[model samples]
Target: KISAIANEYGLSVDLQTKVWQLTVGQQQRVEILKALYREVDILIMDEPTSVLTPQEVDQLFTTLRTLVDDGLTIIFITHKLDEVMQVSDRVTVLRKGKVVATILTTKTDKPSLARLMVGREVIFRLEKSRLERREKILEVNNLQALNDRGIPAIRGVSFDLFGGEILGVAGVSGNGQHELAEALTGLRKSTKGRVFLGKKDVTNSSAREMNDLNVAHIPAERIRIGVVPALSIRENLILKKYRHSPFSYGEFLDNKEIEENACRAISDYHIDAPSCETPVKLLSGGNIQKVVLARELSENPGLIVAVHPTYGLDIGATEQVRQVLLAQRERGAAT
Candidate 1:
């Protein structure tokens, strides 16, 4: 019966598959199937398309439309105005725990909805400088790596990124994008080929070595790999530079300098926290991402390897992250 339903909805996922093995889109499909399997009258999706690829998003929208046609009610909740415009028949604008408006999708536009939700005009487009490709910053030649299951993930991937360039690795979640990023950042070992930082062959170098080369990485799993959640924001901000002169003096940490550094980062990155002493785990996802960005991009590293940088951030946070990356590119950093 489940197979039949899955077939009907174009959901071909294996019921026996482990959650860890599934892609972000497949995980979302599983969640949708779980709800549908119960024969529910109404479905409420909160940011269902947050981590899906472009293809997965279109497939999901098709499936949702089909379900709606078959008399199922779906409440799709997301901060993305574009998604709302595409998939919703009606959109409800809520601000400060109150509904400002609930109108038909055709009756309004993204700009109108943005104004209603935020009480101000939101700019969706950004002004980017002309592209001027510079010297090669990162060169991956025939790189190969494995995933956690001891299976081949990144298979002989080769790419060259120049300074002031943003090379996007686009594929579904289960693909080797994760492993490739890890191999480049030295979080995963490559069985073959070499990675070059300019003329330096730095393949299979440790994360510390990569750091020494000034290779900044904003990991996909931000909570797990990006920041130490139990640590205070101040400590997390200085996680990379703690052993340096300003943060440390021989064997002891200079608390005053560290606090000042944290304060500066908090203000610069617009991190919303009661204080720098606040634990990172207590802050919102967007703020946590900001902390990660603050730490990674603070030094203006040569190569910025960001995997799903704005994965779970809200609209405003998402735009902020994109702008930051663009700003980095403008300064001749390769992303």
Candidate 2:
């Protein structure tokens, strides 16, 4: 399996190295095989569905269903309510770093669990366009991109993202999805062809340059690209927005303004933290992702590059993330 993943990453490493080169999705698959190899009775998965696509997720669920039927104990730690409702017989909701609610999965809905966790009216679905949409927002033509290893990642891919569309790029691990996302958001330079934001050519724009153009990105690798673990939540929140916000008054930094923005994002995104002064690493995966999502989604950018936005999130969190993105799309943001 690692050798198979190596083919995707174009790495010459051994099976261990092959596993290292593969994406999170591929790694999950490898772990499953490893469990089988060792004849393990119990399988503990943390954010197991985070890196998988919808189809892959279904397949995994089916396999787990079979396993459960065969009397295997699978302990899954996640924040997704839908997954619990679907696959789990018993449900547990954790809040403030502790388990607050545990009950039968069949009796609990998203709202019930979410309200118990956060104490609020949780709308699982986003109101979206019931009408037609027009105009092309972003265009990619004959585009080619490479990963960090200087190997071809995206080869001759072309697509048009419309003015109000959530065009999900679904693929197995290492099918050029990450490279394509990087190219779209300017984290990586394209090897050939063009990328246009509306009609403006932005083929080789830098990350900073893309941000200047109201382009926001939800990076696939959250720990690597999204946040600095050591930084305070407030600091991380304003990391990208400081250059062009109330947080900056010309050449001076406005500490109060930064605090305000951070507070707003935290509250709105339901980030589970005691205060904005807390280090981002101290927060749970769901809360950390919420902070990142809030920062980008609240920006109301003209273009949002959401790569694996719901990765590492549970069903309820996944629904919220999807709702936020859908709401933005309905408001005519070219995502």
Candidate 3:
């Protein structure tokens, strides 16, 4: 019956696959599958299309329309104005904790909705300065890696990234993007290949070793891999650099210094929280991502490995994130 229902809804995730091994998009499909298995009449989907491919998104819209026609109700929550215009019958715009407007989706356009959500004119286009293409920062030669399921994920990958350059790896979500990022950041070991940091061969180094080498990573799974949710924002900001001077005094953490660092990050990153003492789990997804960025980019890393950095972020926050990366590039950092 489960299989039948999943097929009926066009849910195509592998039942035997481990959740960790699955891509974000596949995991999202599994979540919808879980809901379908329970036979719910109403579904609440938040950022459903964020990780999905264009084709997957279209299929999802078709499925949603079918479900609606068959007397199912869906509460779709997303920051994407176009998705709202496309999928929603009625729209409710929220800013801070208040609802700015709740009207029929057909009655309003994208521009008006954007202004309502942000309380200002929000620019969609971002201008990035030309890449300087300086010295070689990273070299991956014949890199081979396996996924969590012990299946070959990264297959003989090779690339060179230069300082002040942004290299984009384009592929479908399940096609080794995570494995490659892990291999580069030392979270996953490559079976065969030499990874060189400048001239130094640092193949299969530990994650901590990579951190010590000033390698910055913006992981796709924010809550799982990015921040420690139970900890305070202050502690998470100093997660990487806490072992060093000023942040620590022998076995004890320097509370004043930690708080000061947190204050600077909170202010600079524009993180919306009650205070630095607030737990990361309480913050929104965008704020949590800001915390991750603040921690990773603070030391001015030589090489940054970012995977879907601005996924699920609103228009304003997305623009800000891109500008920050461009600024890092301006400092001759490899991205």
Stretches of candidate 3 off by over 4 Å are none
Candidate 2 local distance difference test against the native? 0.79
RMSD of 3: 1.5
Report, for every candidate in turn, its global Cα lDDT versus the true structure: 0.89, 0.79, 0.91
**Relative to the unseen true structure, what is the C-alpha lDDT of residue 20 in candidate 3, on a scale of 0 to 100?**
72
Model 2 residue 34 CA deviation in Å? 4.7
Residues 1-335 of candidate 3: C-alpha lDDT, one tens digit per residue? 76787788887878887887789988998888888778799999999888776778888999999889989999999988878988999999899889989999889998898899878888787787776469999998999989888889989999899999998887766889989999999899998989999999999999999999999999988999999999999999998989998899899999999999999999999999999999999998899999999999999999999999988998778878998998999999999
lDDT tens digits by residue: candidate 2, 1-335: 54653343232233544555677677777777666556568988777777776677787887788767777898887666667678888877777568898898877787788788766666666567564676888999999988766778888999998877778787876788988888888888999999999899999899888988888899877787899999989989888878776888889889998888889988888887889999999987768888888777766887899888878775557777888888788877877
lDDT of 1 by residue, 144-236 (tens): 888876788888899899999999999987788878888988888999999999999999999999998999999877888899999999999
Query: Model 1, stretches more than 4 Å misplaced?
Result: 96-98
Clashing pairs in 2: 79-314, 80-314, 80-315, 81-315, 81-316
Looking at candidate 3, the ten consecutive residues that score lowest on lDDT are: 124-133
lDDT at 84, model 1:
90
Candidate that would win on lDDT: 3
Q: After superposition, how far is residue 263 of candidate 2 from its true place, in Å?
A: 2.0
The 10 consecutive residues of candidate 1 with the worst lDDT sum are 17-26
